[model samples]
Target: MTGATRTTEHSAADDDVSRRLLESSATLSYDPMTEIDWEAPLPEDGYGLNPEWSTLYGTPLWDEMTEAQRVTLTRHEVCSIMSTGIWFEMILQQMILRDQYVHNPANAEFQFALTEIADECRHSIMFARTCAKLDVPAYFPRKDVVEAARIFKSVAGGEVAYGGTLVAEEVLDVMQRDWMRGENVLDIVRTSSKIHVVEESRHMKFARQEIREHMEGISPLRRRASAALIALGASVIVRSLVNYGVYRAAGLDTRRAVEAAANNPHRRSMMRTACAGLMEFLDEAGLLTRPAVAIYRRVHMI
Candidate 1:
């Protein structure tokens, strides 16, 4: 059999996956606007996320913090993560839009790509509302990081684009599972996380399939380059997940909190645990290059 025949069959399988995913989304997609009670009052003691998921969790700083401070810190940390989610969501939307440009609209793949973008737009709005409801200010990635992503999104190929999307989504999938069920968590945050968990499962599936399809028949040099790019993207995302401003908002010394969080063993363990499946996927796709492993380790996502 010729390579062309193999390619055609592979493409068909991708479309089959896309069609199934599209049907699943149409059947189960949610509107956060109506699903959540935006006007509900938050309890004074409620946390924005599971305390265990906090960056400073299990650290000396965490033990020193009062109960009220713990609540405030987790709330700010969760909001900061939401802010980062919005940032990455916008970038992935642009990347997918470009990937599907001028494609056959009748194809299941194209349709699902658009559907994912629409879902991302909604998720961003959902995150924004949760932040506002909690009275948490917008916490942005660094100016340089934002500018770098602006350029990356505008020009990234479908390979790194989908790989990076998978990284971001996979990291959040595990945490959202905990947040949505966390007792004494804020009602708005819990509802928002529940919505995201259900929808993002589909998005992560789509991204993994897309990356697998894109990786097929690529050259070694190209694979290595894509691996490094994806790893770099992950580092940027992990670093920006909880901005330093969150510490200040929780009324701690920013530098000290940052230092403690950076050295927190529990945080490292959680990050590595969260990324295990993503790393396995990347390895199977021939994208777990040595350089990529090094970068993932640096980010403690190995």
Candidate 2:
């Protein structure tokens, strides 16, 4: 087929996907301010997330901790993840805005893109408030990681941008699914996780659609580079999810906690399980290059 015909076909397919996503959003979107009961008192015995999902879970260190210490560590860890969510949401909002710049505002694609951005804005606010309610200190990624993301948010586009977004969303999606169902988890966290899971399901769908669209005509070399870049981004995000400060806040030896977390077999298994679907998707999309797999292995995401 001719180039113009292919372009028209691609545009038509994208419009259909965007239209469905827009309809879905209008049908089921949430306002976290109203949906979450921010004023609810947290139960003293509640975990911030599922204990099995904890980075230190099943380790000897975890066995040595008291119930109160376990609760504190989990709360700090969850807050750290929330802080990282906020950081990446900011990066994604900027990247999406740049990607849609100068595009036809009348198109469904543009409209849905903006809708995703609005969703992310609310998500960040919800996470910030949740952390405050948990009484955990605000956590941030390492300084160099922040600087690298600054460059990424400014220049990354197409499959690289959407792929990274998908990786982050998918990773959190799996964990939040468990969090929302954790009977022992804090009500605030469970409610927030429910809201996030509902909204992020749509965002993940949109990101996957965008990634597929952008990958349609790229060269093999470019695809390889995109794969590596996305893997790098994923590694950074996973590594930063639970800040080292969380250990100190839990009153553990920071060095021991970090080492225990890194070598925790159960935690690595959880990471691998959470990323199974994501790995399948990446492999299908030709983004799971050898280098990308190696990076994913480093983070125990594969």
Candidate 3:
């Protein structure tokens, strides 16, 4: 087939996918403001997320903590993750906007891209409100990581942008599926998680579609480089999910808590489980190069 014919076919397929996504959004999108009971009081015994999903869970340090301390620690950890969520959501919004710039707005793909942006805007606000209701202070990634992300959001595109997005969303989706169902977790967190999981599922699907489209006919060297970049992005995100301040907030020694969390076998296992589908997807997309695998292994995400 001629190059123009191939390009037209690809565009048509993308439009079909976007049309379906738009239909899905119109049928079942949410309004977090009304979906969440922002006024409800948090139970003293409630956890911020499922205990099994905690970074320190199953560690000796976790075992040593009192019930109240555990509750506090988990709350801070969840809020920390939510803060990271907000940060990445902003980066993604910028990346999407840039990607769509000068594109045909009449196309379904462009309209759905804007719709996804709208969903992320709502998600960021929902996460911020959830953290405020949990009474936890804002948590940020390291100074260097923050600076690096600023650079990344400015130039990242194609597979790297969508791959990083899919990785983050997939990792969180696995955890939130449990959080939304955790009977011992706070009702506010559960409601918020439910909203996030539902909305982000569609986003993940869209990212996967975008990544596949962008990977077409790319060179091996570029593919490897993109894989490494995406893996690096995932490592930064995973490392920042639970800030060290969370340990101090629970009145534990930061050094010890960090050490324990780093070596916790169960926590590593949880990460591997959470990222199983993501790993498979990356592998299928030819984005799981040797270097990328090493990076994922360092974060226990493989």
Candidate 4:
């Protein structure tokens, strides 16, 4: 055989191995319908929220709604955003998992990502159905440039980006679940939230470990690039909720909601707070290093 032919065959073999790794690790099982007790009663303890939830009350925009409207808004706010966020994230994950199969199919990481893709699908369906049960319509806008960038960056950054995201988000999940410890206002939400928290804990831990491993090998410039991309992805994920039905029911315009949310000082402060907490969490997880920290700080995210 010619040398060129041999090299081509060798490359093909390596590709085959990577593909196999991904496929092998991709199998996972979870039944959304059977996983949570949907009939659970809603807890009454302060509406199952952290005291900081009062921040919503402090906002002039939130005050525009009537008391009954406030109740509807709150319920809609939590379930709708959670549902939408899960839906978008899962869709992105599924795409990424498919790409993994195509690009490096046989790798264990690819396989594991495949399993996660399945989990994300289940989660998206579960959340959508839950929203339907709560009388909220589920809708996702057509993909736009910003959304596309987020999906791309998230997939590119892989486990580390996923982990950093979880660091900011998981604590919110924990806080939400904790609200259910005593009261169950929105029983379905409480139960589903519980299931989510339990499942996401594993994803978060794995992402953190992967990020720590990668950070060691990445140069300072690469780390900054990673941070910026991840942060941009995070920003898009954060901004995608402008079209939620709850905003409509509150007699609010979606565009205005987006604008208000973007320029809101209080929200900015909350963002800083969440990012800071995420940094602390990453540090505790052994991922906070000079380069990573520098990137985060330079971006003014932490």
What is the per-residue lDDT of model 4 for residues 173-271, given as tens digits with 9 covering 90 to 100?
545555456353566766666666655554555455445544554465665566655555454554554345556765667666545555556655654
Measured with C-alpha atoms, the lDDT of residue 142 in candidate 3 is 95
Question: For each candidate, what TM-score against the reference?
Answer: 0.96, 0.96, 0.96, 0.67
Candidate 1 lDDT: 0.89
Worst lDDT run of 10 residues, candidate 1, spans: 1-10
User: Model 1 clash tally?
Assistant: 0
Query: In candidate 3, residue 290 scores what lDDT?
Result: 97
lDDT by candidate, in order shown = 0.89, 0.91, 0.90, 0.53
Candidate closest to the true structure, highest lDDT: 2
lDDT of 4 at 301: 47
lDDT (Cα, 0-100) at 197 in candidate 1: 91
- On residues 200-264, what C-alpha lDDT tens digit does candidate 2 reach at each position? 99889888888888888889999999999999999999999999998898899999999999999
- lDDT for model 2, please: 0.91
Q: Which pairs of residues clash in candidate 3, taking residues 3 or more apart in a chain or in different chains?
A: none
Model 1 misplaced stretches (Cα beyond 4 Å)? 1-10
lDDT, candidate 1, residue 181? 96
